[model samples]
Target: MRNARFLWELISYRPASASCRTLFMLACYGERIVFGLAIQAFFNTLPQHTQMTPELFVLFLPWLIAIAVRLIVVNFGTIGAVRFEFSAQALLQHNLFKHILQRPGFQALPDSVGNTISSFRDDTAIVVELLSHLGETCALIIYTSVVFIILLRVNVLITLLVFLPLCCIVVLARQAQKGLEKYRRASRTATSNVTGAIGEIFGAVQAIQVAGAEQHVVAHFHTLNAQRRASMVKDRMLSGALDALFGNVGDIGTALILVLAALSLTAGQIRPGDLVIFLTYLAIVSDFFTDIGSLLAQQTQARISFERMTNVIHGMPDHQLVAHHALHIHDKVNEESAPPAVPQPVVVPLQQLVVRDLCYRYPETGRGIAGINICIQGGTLTVITGRIGAGKTTLLHTLLGLVTADAGEITWNERPVADAAAFFIPQRSAYTAQVPHLFSDTLRENILLGLPEHEHTNDLSTAIHTAVLDHDIAALEHGLDTRIGVRGVKLSGGQIQRVAAARMLVRQPALIVCDDLSSALDIETEQLLWDRLRTSRTQTCIAISHRRSVLQRADQIIVLKQGQVEAAGSLEQLLTTSQEMQRIWQGSE
Candidate 1:
């Protein structure tokens, strides 16, 4: 029942092609039935002819024409089936990518990058195979049913006896299915781990070589590879065993049918032609049983793949699940009449943003920010400073809705934060993460990502100047057109961070949230970056920094200690009144 539901949902991705898929399958079955009838007709007329007589020719003509017509239909059906399969595969790939991208926040992905690739590549291909076999499985059942009925009419007792062993075959296959599923799941996981490891190792090959850990990394990879091989071998062995057992059962059934036919012939209860037809039909039935066994085995693997994909795509918190379902239904109902949703422009409120009694805790360690209260005024630079692990990053993440707050109230423009029209980092409110990511593209493209092409030239120049990256760009051989390589490997660490900052600036977001944007920059570059930011009085800035220069320039400063707000004021006020703030500033100096 679960497998049936999985198959239905898998095919539901391409509803328009459903009819074509069905018609193609029916045509295939029709071809098989016609071929079987042609064989039966030839056998029935064989004993009556010494050579090809006119009467025999007349008898054969109808079967020949029927076979020819079915063959033509089969050819057309094959073309349709292939087209549908490719189309469905493409649709599934697109949907998977769309779903992954649409997930709420930066931490939305539930699997490693390699696992996601596996789901997109290997898992989707498996689904296509399952879909193809699903159609063939249906056609096989119909053909088997017709052949079995013919066999029953020929000899009821013999037919019943021949089919009895199928029960045992099914039971054995069912038992093997559980083991096969377990092995396949394990094999898939192993494959994902190996893929992820290779990606990580390759991306950091220089570091590995520098650290002299090449042998260690290879040994770890070999262990994972060996595990995958073992799991795969077990899965394949179990599937092959089931197929062999079913084939042997089919052979036994045929032997029993032949023996019964011989007895019936001797007793004059059946003619030689009858025996010929019965044996030919028996072969068809035997082939059906073998196919069914193979289909069942393949299904076990498909079921695992389907479950893996659905779990990743659909698994979410209960509230999120309900919201997702409601949104899906809404979209489906209004899809035809409704215009596509355009992203609304980010409109920063020109009023105070307030956080009161905000609290959030990480599940793993049970430690996060708690009872945090602060007010951020628009058109001001607010700096949060603390030692490492003081929840600066977590506070920013929670405020941006990247992490759920366990307890709190955040208001923007006197409205609840959830109801307010404010963009978070990497969206309308641009963010430069502590460790920024850069694509392997031209510097111009990287900075101007998702911005309109018309604004590209001006925005790119302004952003580079603001982030103090113009000098670096000028040093590059191709200027802004230079390709940065993977993760901006060709650039220095400080340059990568500035490129990220420039990317944020290119968006021209009213609110900028940066985490340690100057960590890698020298004092000269860092000072220039802040100097440019200070000149932008119309934009609001929220940054995490411990630099004395940044602290002195901040319009408001909030110091955190052990996940709680230890101090909040201008730099001078905090330095004079709070010992912790004094220590932090003195340490920075």
Candidate 2:
């Protein structure tokens, strides 16, 4: 009953493709039935030896024609099945990626990308084999049932004797099933481990080199490979044993049936030619049933693969609300028409950020920020400082809507940030973290991420100058026309950071929240970055920094201790009035 529901759901979810699958199955079954009946009729008619002349040869013509039709139908069904598998796989991949993009932070599902590749690349074969085997299994079942009924018509007692041994086959098959399940689970885990390792190594090649952990990574890869090899060996050993045992049993049954039919003929209960025909049908039935058991095992493994793929495709992530609002960003092809005006800012009230008894917890570890309350006025360069793991990053993530708060309300301008109203710059800078993805095009094209229609070519030069990267690009061969390599690999860390800054500035966002992006820069460069930020009037900057020089320019400072606010005020007010703040400044001095 449960299996029926699963098939129904699968069909409903993919109706158009399911129709093709149904046609494929029907064609396979039609061919199998026609072929089986023809084979049976051919052997049964051979008992009439008296009239077997040249005219008797005409009886075999229908059998030959049925065999040809069966081949054509089966081939067509196989082709159709393959096409459906490919289309379904593509749809699954697209949906998985789209779902991940909607997930918060996206980093939380580190294995999602690996799962996608494994499902379509590695697991697709399993699905294809499963469908193919299922068609064959269905054909075998139909042929066996028709032949079995014919055997019963000849003699009920003999038919009962034949069924007795099949009971043993079923019991043995059940025992082998346990082993198959164990190995199937092991193989899936090993596959996922290998995929994850490859993705990690390739994605962080630079980090691996800097850390000098190449050998360690290779060693881990070998471990996963060894596990996979061992799992395959286990499955093969068990399957091989079952195959040999089942074959031996089938041989014994065939011998018994032949001996009984010979005895019946000697007793004058049946003719010699009838025994010959019965034995022929017995061979076909035995082979069909034996193959059924093996196909069932393969189906078991395919089921495991299906479950693993679906879990990744269906898993939920944090901050994915019911989506009461939407900020649909369509792919812009070119900048021909006037760029649409940036949508009007979501009008908000209170002129500040309000947090009421907010709480947040990590997925793996329950340890996260607890209840807290605070209000931060807009237009203030608020700086938050705390000890390591004191929830500074967590608070920032919550504010940016990267992580969901366990219990609390964070209202921006008296309204929640339901859409892309603000920009967030993580601690590593966009280039260092996001890899500064650049196409093989001009520098000007790369800077304009979406190319707002209102934007002009001059905006590129303005952004470069404001980011203090004009001299750097001028040193390049083609200036703005120079092509950046994939992920800007040709650029240095500082250059990548500056380029990312320029891209962000091109949007002219209302809010810029930087999480210590200038840590890698020298004092002068950092100072210049702050100077450029000051030139914008309406844009607000909220910085998270512990550096004394960085904090000196902030209009307000908030000290966090043990996940709770310790002090909040201007630098001068905190230095003279708060002991902890005074000590921090004195120590830095």
Candidate 3:
């Protein structure tokens, strides 16, 4: 029943296309039946004869014509099926990608990258094949029904004998299906683990080499690979066993029909021509049963794939941010006009930002921020500082709606922070993680992602300058056109951070939430970046930084101790009253 629902979902992707393919499949089956009748006619024309007469030649003509028609219909049917498979595969991949992107954030994804990739590629392909088999299964049912009716008319006893064995095959096949499903699911999971391990190892190849842990990594990979191989072998062995059993059953059924026909012919109960037609139809019936067995076996694998993909597409915890309709900032801009005259880029500002006793805990460890309260005024700089493991990053993530809060409320301009109507541009609230990620693309493309090409020129230049990345761009051979390589490997650590900063800047967000934006930058560059940011525009800046320069410039400084706010005030005020703040200040100096 679950398999039926999965099949229906796949067909519903493009019902018209599926219908067309099914029609062609039916035509192919019809041609096969006609070909069998043609053979029966040829036998009737030449029964107990040796000479080739004009009438025999005429019978031969229909047989030849049936072969020709079958060839054409089979070709068209194959073409239609291939086209449908390609289309369905493409749609499934697109939806999988979109669904992954719409997930709350990276933390919500499957633990292993390989597992997701398996669903995206291997599982989707399996489901598409399942769709093809399902269509063929339907066609085979109709073909088998017509052939059985013909056989019954020719000799009811022989048809009944063939039908009883097939019912037994069905019962046996069902039992095998349960075991096949369990093994196939295990095999798929093991394969995903192997894939994920390989992906992770390759991604961190440099780290492995640097740490001189090549042997250890390979050992772990071999363990996963061995598990995959064992599971796959078991799955294949079971499937082959079922295939052999079904094939033998079909052969026995064929032999029984032939034997029955011989006896009937000797008894003068049926003509030789009638025997010929019965044998031909019986062959079709045997082939149909064999196909049904194969279909059932494959169905188990497809069901596993379908369930894996469905979980990925639907398992994400509901995120209010994703539910909110994206506000197109470009739509509000005057596209025809020249760039803005302001020397410093202008950003849309949040009217008021408020957080009341927000609390969130990590699911695994049950440790996170608690009773965190702070007010962020629009167009001001708010800096959060603390020692390691103080929950600064967690607090930032909670405010950005990347992680769900256990309790408390966050509002912007008297509206719930998650409300769609609260802001026209969600990009107005941008976040830069502590470790910035860069795609393997041109520098300009990375900075201006999702923005129109027209908006890229002047805004990109301004953002590059603001992030202190202009010097790095100037040093490159291709300037902004240079491909940065994976994770910006070609650039220095500081340059990668700045590129991420520039990306956030280009959006001209009303609120900029950055985590350790200057961690990789030199003291001088860090000072310059913050100085420029401070005087640039009225955009509210909330950042986690330890730099004395940033602390001095912050309008409000939040000092966290463990998961709770230890101090909140102007830097000087905190330095005077809080021992933790004093210690942090002294350490920085």
Q: Write the per-residue lDDT of candidate 3 for residues 1-589, one digit (tens) a residue.
A: 7667656765765666676556677776777677677767777667656887777666556657766776786677677667668777776676677776655564546556788899889988887887887787788789888888877787899889879978887787888788898899999999999888888886787899999999999899889989989999999999898888777766788788788878987899877777777766666677677778888877777778767776677664322101222223225466565454324333335778888899989989988999998988888899999988999999987777676678888877767766322232335667789999899999988888757768567877888999999778999999999999987889888999999999998877888889999988888999999988877657889999888888988999999999999999998799889999998898887
Once fitted onto the true fold, the runs of candidate 1 whose alpha carbons sit more than 4 angstroms away are 1-3, 12-16, 19-22, 86-99, 104-106, 314-341, 419-422, 425-428
Taken over the whole model, the C-alpha lDDT of each candidate is 0.77, 0.64, 0.79
Among the numbered candidates, top lDDT falls to 3
Which candidate model has the greater TM-score, 1 or 3? Answer: 1
| Model 1 poorest 10 in a row by lDDT | 318-327
Candidates arranged by lDDT, highest first: 3, 1, 2
List, residue by residue over 75-191, the lDDT tens digit for candidate 1.
777776676677666655666665665654545567788888888788877877877877777766787788778767767877788787776677667777778788888989999
| Global lDDT of model 3 | 0.79
lDDT of 2 by residue, 33-132 (tens): 4544555555566666666576556655766776676567657755666555554444444545556566566343546566667766766567555655
Residue 326 of candidate 1: its Cα lDDT?
12
Predict model 1's lDDT versus the native: 0.77
